[model samples]
Target: MSRPLTATINLAALRANYLLAKRLHGGKVLAIVKANAYGHGAARCAQALAEVADGFGVAAIEEAIQLREAGIRQPILLLEGWFEASELPLIERYDLWTAMHSLSQVADIEAATLSRPLTVWAKIDSGMHRLGIAPSDFPELHARLEATGKVGKIVAMTHFARADELDCDTTPRQSACFMAAIAGLKVETSLCNSGGILAWPDLHGDWGRAGVMLYGGTAADRQLPDWPQAVMNLDSRIMAVRELSAGEPIGYGGGFVTERPTRVGVVACGYADGYPRVVPSDTPVLIDGQRGRIIGRVSMDMLTVDLTEHPHAGVGTAVRLWGEGLPAAEIAASAGTIDYELFCNVKRARFEYQG
Candidate 1:
């Protein structure tokens, strides 16, 4: 069988990042493994961090159940909480925590009758306006949930809108609002995500949700004393190599015009495989452990790279799209995007988990 174009994940590195996040926050770490641990394979990553993470954070109730089925004993916080009222039973069965952001969720909890009271977190909408309850309604929301005998514990939390921008004052302002809204509640709090955990220490609370930072990506450009290793090395093989003459166009729509006699390497990966489709020619791709630039437009199943400077180019050679020696942020830049996009877009067909 042929080795498919795939990404190799470093499980050790993931654990290190989780440990670092915990150390930085000086509190419990909720390893945010949502979106398949940002495409690094949630089950694998969570299993590796089970001993270290105080808990896990996932977007859906099913993901929480998956961890439980996989033997993960740590508390799992549902980031989106229960989408439907019916999910409450499963959440309670798994002892997973839910983030009650809206009035409907409060009603669901009130209607629930589990053997054990449900652990709930109040998500305050300081500014993101994505989810969470309004600051003005925090008091009333808290009262309603507490009134329900099903409430086990309540945590006050909020999401940061500008956590990735170091200079953005919104993080601090949001923190103030969250604190004000939850005043006198006397419960544990959690407000920090990846960016907040790494850059804004003040945002750290009783618990922090560490995401991208635990995957070896820097948030807010803040440098850690010992950065975590890249967990995913996305690579493909060189299918063919060709020599081109000056003035000759390369790839579709003539996006690349050769400046001189040049060599092009065709790689076996494309947008269909989760490589960005918008990536223009001249995007950098590592060939044979050497830096090479894309020569033409990206296609659905393949893309070409300029290999004039690579002396050892040939068939079946390897190309590092990201991770390993190549940084994801750099690859994202070449494709006119961000590291988050590249990580999240990794298709299911390509994968090899190290953990």
Candidate 2:
């Protein structure tokens, strides 16, 4: 038999989380399926939500093309726009919405020959200092895209830098800047990511990008008290159980030592399965539906969990690395990462999808 490791994608929970975003945001919501729906398998997740989602968001033209190939008929927006001039033709052929974040991208749009006008999302770098046109330059960008006569229905959008931080003023400041920049432009706008939707209802726009939250992730810790249901779980099993004395050292580098008699279960999951190797001792997991924790270095193929709390846990006992009962955010916090990274990095695990 294969290794007892699996990443179960919960499609019902996926739809629930998405509908929650749609209901809560009270506007058009684009399910961000970039990075293979954050590694939940884009095609399946997109199909599950195909009936309700306003559209989908991806990082580039390739991802959009993949969705189109998968028969995702809804609007697909390329969040990063085209990588080079050559991709413009593919963008047109796929009927994809492209984000115009740079003057060079504008030049490419102007010079391209197209079968029809394209939907454009005009990106404003109100904050985040990432891939977006400057607020000062947005007016010129809009004019140029319109002048080309190859663009139609420009949607103003911006990514929030600090929407996850409830106490931060950055979101409000950025929102004000974006609104001021787009004033009198008479274009629909998209400003909220998952964090923005959760925290600032007053700032909701014509369109919102539901990203991390769509796959059971979050606005992170601030909204942990009531984040939506997790859509995927990393499950594994104990391969072996070890009884050790108080002074025994565990795993690589002897970094963790037992202070008491310990019951350790070697889980069939490790860094190779996308569990973080740098996770310090006491990282959380679930054994036979009971709480457990990791206690040593994670090898490529296996890691040891403290099963002393559960006297009945042994080889073949079920284990959950994260999801459902055990949140991915908790494991990510222990590893000094985020749930997005944990989901995107999963590998070497059989997938089981359930509603």
Candidate 3:
């Protein structure tokens, strides 16, 4: 038997999440499986969701090619589109749908001479201002792509700048801006990310891209069209348990001191294993399905959790850092970080799949 220092991935939960996202979009769902499915293993996650998802979205062309080679016949939308001119041929070969955001990418697409017409998506710079062509340039780019004869279906896409901010006005502004730019062309539209799909229902368009929400993480307050199930549980075992007297310091720099007689448990996971070191003292860790708080600085290979409240906790007890009743967002909030970073930072540890 292996130690409990492993991540358990639930494929059934992932499929349920896919269906939830699809129901919310009220159209075809383009599952965002980039960043190795947000650190849940891209290939496996994609394969698990293949029957439920209409398509897949990845940040790189290489990832799409990998899926294609694996016999995943679904359409793959390249979120970053072409990084360089040399990637054009590979994009065509894989039948990838490129999200065209810059003039150089447009030029690369026009210059490439492939056997069949390549599908191109015109990404508008709505409000993120990170990539995508300006609205003023959209019409000209659309004209050039139309003239290229090598271009196939052209969908207009934009990302919301503040869809997660429930009270922010940016989502609507970006949505209006995107709609105004594509009003004339009337091609397929994809403006909603996970946040928009859940919080701003009006922003959902012809296609919807769901990422974090499909993993049971909330981006906004709105209820999911279908309930998204938690897909991963990060757990470990208590390697050591000890009792401490009043005022005894715990871990490095004495970040935590026992206020009274206390019992503590040490888990075999730390920053090296992707558990954040910056998590404040007293951040919650789970033991025997009860909550225990970290009582000291998170060390490189272990973290100390005060089990004074749960005296029955002992060595070899399973400790869940997140998942189940403890959501990743709650842990992230205590760590002064966000859910996305925590999800993507899962280190090189063994994983057990339950779904």
Candidate 4:
């Protein structure tokens, strides 16, 4: 048959995670489905969450349009807003919500005439300087958008730069700035990302955007009482197994050399399949339900694992790259990256969705 590699998307777990976010925050949740639902397949994941989510968040207008085409009826927020004025029409046609982060975006929104007034999220750059107007400029911008009468409800929002760090003071400082900026405004507010939703309960407002955690990725310093279920199980199979003598080098560049008699299993997964090639030799992998350590530099199509501890594992032995019993966060940490990158980088595996 075809390659014994598959990326299984767990729809039931995805729904449960969304509901968990709702229960934890006790507010409307803008399910962050940007970057293809953090690479879990946006259309499928969004459809699964459509019934319960307050709304969905995407990185741009194109993603929102794609969801609309897929029959997703939930309100989709453009987290990064429109890139150009031309996208404003599509945003209006799709009935999408836009974030006004820059003065130029505000100008573009004001100049466009739409069939209905558009909902806007006035973004303030409390700490993250990547996108958003300064706190000092938020008042005038909000007033300007309101005066145009072309906008519907305007929600004040900001992104926390250090919500994941429990010891960091940046979140509190940014929250204070945002609070001061929108102190007397009549608009509702949102500031919590997944980390904020879990760690800083006070930051949850009219809306909380849940991203990585909804897919079973960790966001805080400590584990919570309610951990999200893993929504994607990346698996493969052992294609071959061999016995190696002491001092034998394995894989490319001799990155790993056997010190004693060892058994190795070649897994049908590698960097090309979105597995991190740079993962350290000690990174763990599961083969036939037994833990094994990667032994050498990962190749494009395959990688070798130390299977000496499990002599029963041979060709066709089940292998789990991440998810389910093995956490992606743990793998990512060993790879010098984050779970978000690992999820978004998956592109070469066959998909199997389960409810």
Which candidate wins on lDDT?
Answer: 4
lDDT of each: 0.85, 0.90, 0.86, 0.90
Residue 256, candidate 2: Cα error in Å is 1.7
1-355 per-residue lDDT for model 1 (tens digits): 4545888989999998889899999998899999988988888889999887899999998888888888899899998887789988888778888887897678777777788888888899999999998898988888887888788789988999889998778999999988998888768899999899888887799999998888887566787667857888899888888899999988779968999999888888889888898877767778889888887888888889888888788888889888878888887887777887788888845577775
Q: Estimate the TM-score of every prediction.
A: 0.96, 0.97, 0.97, 0.98
Q: Please list the residue runs of candidate 4 whose C-alpha ends up more than 4 Å from where it truly belongs after superposition.
A: none
lDDT of 4: 0.90
Ordered by lDDT, highest first, the candidates read: 4, 2, 3, 1
> Which regions of candidate 1 fall more than 4 Å away from where they truly are?
none
> Alpha carbon lDDT of residue 222, candidate 4?
57
- How far out, in Å, is residue 189 in model 1? 0.5
Candidate 2 lDDT, 1-355, residue by residue in tens = 9999999999988888888888879999999999999989998999899998999999987788888888999999999888898888898888888887887788888889998999999999998998798998888888888899999789999999989988889999999999999888879999999998888899999998999999888673445444579999899999999999999999999999999999999999889788899999988889998888899899999999998889988899999999989988889888888889999999999998898
Q: What is candidate 3's lDDT per residue for 1-355, written digit by digit as tens?
A: 7656888999999998888888877988899989988988888888888887899999998889878877789999999888788988888777888887887677776777788988887899998999889988888888888888988799999998788899989999999999888877848999999998888877799999999987887777676445656788999989998889999999999978899998989888889888889999878878889977888899888999888888778988889988876888888998888878888998856887766
> Backbone collision count in every prediction?
0, 0, 1, 0
Q: In terms of lDDT, which candidate is stronger, 2 or 4? A: 4
Worst 10 residues of 2 by lDDT: 218-227
